[model samples]
Target: MRKIIVIGSMSIDLVVSSSKRPEKGETILGDNFFTTPGGKGANQAVAAARLGEQVYLVGRIGDDDFGKEIYENLKDNNVLVDGVEPVTQMPSGTAHITIADQDNSIIVVPSANNEVTIEYVKKHLEQLDSGDIVLLQQEIPSETVAFAIEYCDRNGMISILNPAPYREVSNQVIESATYITPNETESNAMFKGNMEDALQAYPKKLIVTMGDKGAIYHDGNRKVTVDGYKREVKDTTGAGDTFNGAFAVGLQKEYDIEKAIAFANLAASHSVTGMGAQGGMPTLLDLEGEWHV
Candidate 1:
């Protein structure tokens, strides 16, 4: 199996179920609360592992109970954690999430995840190779992402970026990418008004994921849209991660952009059929079994 190296954060997420969001200066009683292993990098790594990809995770987590649980989850799911950097100066990152019906909101404290520096990323650059897939997200600092993207470009590897959390992105990172997977809100934020106009800013292929409506692809010249697979959507927490991770697996197998995007869409559709982040992602056999080519 080809390697899928991921650069991002590892966090412990606490989820609350509420009927309505808290109004300004107002408090509401929540129905349920639970803690789980999450973080864009870790979630995507788990997604790839489920999709039968060999995943190498590179990120920082504090030496705490939450961090320990996350590490156990990664190992249980078969993600390669040898590349994960453990930090003692800070605690593991954590996110407080509230799911109100189909709408959800979150607050995150970066913690040790914010310590994922360019030096740490450079230390792992040699782990990548031609034909291998390099995945990144915004859980960590943009500088680290930039370093990894540029490194992948020079190393002749596939660079896939999932710009989540909707932060302003750097053009250099976009230029060094092989593909940029951004959701509707993120796409609009990255592009401002027009996807075509935003896509033109980078030479890499662009993939815009629209929940339920499926995904749109732009490879510099042509534009294609992949229809989303229909399924019961309990929660959309990890859909994008599943798409990006499954797409990485497709590329590792040398699947074309269309086939890869279709595969990703299928994977994401399957993901929404369940609840939670990693819980919703489908395994390799599950994907192959459900959406056969």
Candidate 2:
């Protein structure tokens, strides 16, 4: 079995929901407040693990209660945490999220996540080999992301780069990554608003995820759009992470691009029907009847 290695951040989420967004300098009542284990990297790890993949999460957490909870959550989800460690004296990473109108806005404090340095990754890199499925996100240092992509290329590993939270991506990184997944906004920013051109430029390599509508990728022959499964929306926080994780599993199963995206779409649709990012993630058994693979 190919190992799924996720190099990213781990954090706790402080979430609040309201019917409307607060204007500047104004305070408003909210519907609910909660905390859950989340972070782009952790969410994807859990998502993949829930789908029955043996996922290894590599990142840093703080030596705090929140960090302990995050660690426990990963273990509960069956994600291997050999690469996850706590940084003494540092605060655990956190995302303060506000949900309004079924959508969300988040403010992240990368605390200990910033400790995922190149040196740290090098210490763990020796364990990886060719054919491993390495999933990554932009929650860690930018240099680490670039190095990992290049390393995967050199080692013959497959790398899926999820550029979230909007960072300025470099051309070399884009070219080096085996797969680059970004949402509509992030894709536009990545390619200077030339989505069609960008898709054509990297057929089969660039996947743009659109919420609810679906995701699209160029097939080298033509543009293929995988329609998303419709589900009642509760919270959309980890829907994209769910998609990335499920997509990685799909690839591990040797499914074609279309099938993989379809599988991811189904999983993402299920993800939004619940509250926390990992709350509604479906197990492989949950996908029995609907998932073709």
Candidate 3:
């Protein structure tokens, strides 16, 4: 199987659960509080690794306790951390998350994650061979993300770009991706139209995810919708990341687009039944008897 190379952010996630969100200048008691390793990049890397893929994560962390935790977490999941660097000047990245009624709101502080430069990405990507799958996210610098995609394109690697926390991305970046996965809101932001129109515009190049409604993809000739598995959602934080990781793994295993998307949908659906980002990802063992392509 081809290796899955992830270029993205790593952070410690501080999460709290409450009955309801507080109003302006209001303080309320929360039900629970916890910490976990998170970040779009790290979450996806762990998801892919747990699914039985050989994975490598390239990012930056701080020389703090949180950074140590992040490193150990990645290592524990069997993701290679040789490309991960520690910077002394900045604290590790962190996300403050609030969950209410199964929905979540997040605030991120991009500390050492800001140090993921184009130079840094290039240095790590140079070690990867062609035919590897390169996964990217927006939590790091946009320029670095763009560069990584372009580099992967130039080198014959399959580059998958997941545009989360949606932002303006260059056409060059968009054009360079082998596939682009975006949720409904992100697709609306990028294409300036409804989901139907966006799907029509980039039929073969885009995968638009609709939570619980499943996902839609066009294989150049026709558009197909894969139904999501029904599950009681406990938290939806890392569902999309799970889908992306599973989708990449399917591609690495040479599954057809439809089969890959179906596999991804199931993985994502299973993810929401658990808590936190990385914590919810299902392993090969978890899916052994249930999932088959």
Candidate 4:
């Protein structure tokens, strides 16, 4: 079995439904509101652990009610949470999300997440190995991400970066990754909306996920595109996270990148059929049935 380590954010999300996104200085009535434990990092960690991977999560949350909720959620999902810390002065990271039918907007305030430093990740580096899969997202500091990826590289562990809420990461960091999974928006943004614009220097493979359109792979030399599964999407909150999680499982199973993305694509399609981020992910059986892989 492959050991998987995920380093990122663990946050509580407050979601509200409205007919339209509110404008500045405008008050809009909402239909309903709900709270869920979510953070791209935490969601992927849970998704991987539930799929039978040996998983570890490194993140930070406020030393408050939300932190307890996050900790319990990870434990209940069988994810190792020893590396998750509680920041006393900082509030737990949280999101205020607004959903209007198909479109959604989010405002994330990184409180405790802002406090998770490279030192925090360095302390947890002892558990890694060449057989392990290390995953890091951008919810925390870029420096921490650099440290984790560098440590994984030196330790011979394969590192995968899911550049969700995409931000600029160093080319050196990108090159260090075994793989970088970016959704369409992130990819386009990272590439400055020029698909023809080549970023040939990255040493690792690149996966660009286009919702409904499917995923494309550039693994150093060849380029392959995997068509996506079709489903009536209820909410797409955690679809990308599901894709990355399932992809990690595929890598652990030694499936090649193309096969892994296909598996992950199917899993992501399953996730959008329901509501919530981690709430809607498919199991291994679900992926098998949906993709017939």
Candidate 5:
């Protein structure tokens, strides 16, 4: 299997379960609260590792308790942390999440995560071999993401970009990526039009993930839709990350794009059956031996 490198944010997620969100200027009681090690990068790394991939996580964390906890969480999941750095002056990143009716609202405070620089990513690229898979998300600096995409292009590696939390990305970054995985909202933000146009623009490189509608893959000339699996959803968090991680593993294993998306869809559906991000992600064994192509 090819090595997978995940570059993005690492955070401590404070998750609360409530019947409804409190209106402005009103405080409401919550059903439950729990702390989990999360962040897009860490979640993807853990997802991939659980699926039997050799994964390395690259991101920045603070020298605080949250940072320590997140680091240990990654280590415990068998994700390599050689590329992780600790920023002494800042606190670790954090996300305040609320889940209601199986939907979620999140507010992220990117502290040390903002400290991940282009230089840091470049340095870590030295540890990757040619043809290795590099997975990235929008939780970190866009400039660093752009640089990493271009660097991977120059190094003959496959670069997959997951534009989550929706932000404006440069054309250079878009074109540099070998694959761009974006959900409906992100696709709209990036292309400013319908999903078809986005796929037309990026061709096979653009993968649009539609929550329960499954995913669509366009190869410029043709479009294919992969239906999502049916499952009881407890929480929707980390489902996309799970899909992306599984997709990367499928690619690393040389599966065709359609097969890869199928694998991803199944993995993502399984993820929603549990609560929390990393906690809900399914392992290869959990796939009931159906993960194989």
Candidate 6:
């Protein structure tokens, strides 16, 4: 199996549950509060590792308790953490999350995560073999994200760019990436005007994930929509990351585009069934053996 390398951030997620969002300058009693190991890169690594992939996470954590827990969480999930480093005198990154009315709002504090610069990432990239899948997100610097895509393009590696938390990305990077997975809102920000036009513009390369509606991509011949599975949603925070990770595993297995998206959607459906980002991710065994294609 091909190794999946996730390059981005490592942080702890502080989550709170409430009946509704408070108004400006208003305070309300929340139902519950908890902390979990999270961050886009860590979540994807755990998701892929849970699905039995040989995954490696490359990023920065802080020299703090949160960082230690994050590292152990990755190890516990069977992810290779040799590329993960701790930045001195920096606190671990964190996402302040509020789960209200079945939806979540997040405020990210990027501390040590900001230390994942291109210089640091290139060192890890040099150690990886060509043809490996390099998964990336917006949690790190935009310049590093762009550089990784170019590096993957030059090295014959497959690049999956999940343009989350919405940021402006260059067209060159978009064109060079093997796949671009963006959610509904993100796709809207990436390509203005018509959605179909955007999908057609990149063919199978641009995958737009619609929450509960599944994901859609243009096959260069026609548009294909992979339907999502219905499940009891306890938390939707990790659904997108689950999809991205599962999709990478599908690609590593050489599944066709439709099959890959279907597998990803299935995994994502299972993700929303539990709380926290990594909590609900399905293991290879949990897929009822459907992973064998």
lDDT, candidate 5, equals 0.91
Of 4 and 6, the candidate ahead on lDDT is: 6
Give the clashing residue pairs of candidate 3, or none.
none
Q: Judge candidate 2 at residue 31 and give its lDDT.
A: 92
Ten contiguous residues with the weakest lDDT in model 5: 284-293
Candidate order by TM-score, decreasing, is 2, 6, 3, 5, 1, 4
Select the stronger candidate by lDDT from 4 and 5: 5
Q: Write the per-residue lDDT of candidate 3 for residues 199-239, one digit (tens) a residue.
A: 76676679998988899987666788998888988999999
**How does each model score on lDDT?**
0.85, 0.92, 0.91, 0.82, 0.91, 0.92
| Best TM-score among the predictions, by candidate number | 2
* Tens digits of lDDT, candidate 4, 134-226: 888888998899888878887889899998788898878877888888877787787777643443434237788887778887666656678
Q: What is candidate 2's lDDT per residue for 1-293, written digit by digit as tens?
A: 88899999889999999999999999999999999999999999999989856689999999999999999999999999999999997999999999999799999999999999999997777788788889999999999999999899889999999999889988899989999999999999989999999999999999999988999999999999999878999999999999999999988888888888999999999999999888888898888899765
Score candidate 4 by lDDT.
0.82
TM-score of each: 0.95, 0.98, 0.97, 0.94, 0.97, 0.98
Model 3: what TM-score?
0.97
Those runs of model 3 whose alpha carbons end farther than 4 Å from true positions after fitting are: none
lDDT-better candidate, 3 vs 6 = 6
Per-model tally of clashing residue pairs: 0, 0, 0, 0, 0, 0
Higher-ranked by TM-score: 4 or 6: 6
Which prediction has more favorable TM-score, 5 or 6? 6
Lowest summed-lDDT stretch of 10 residues in model 1? 196-205
> Positional deviation of 42 in candidate 2, in angstroms?
0.1
Worst 10 residues of 6 by lDDT: 284-293
Give every collision pair in model 2: none
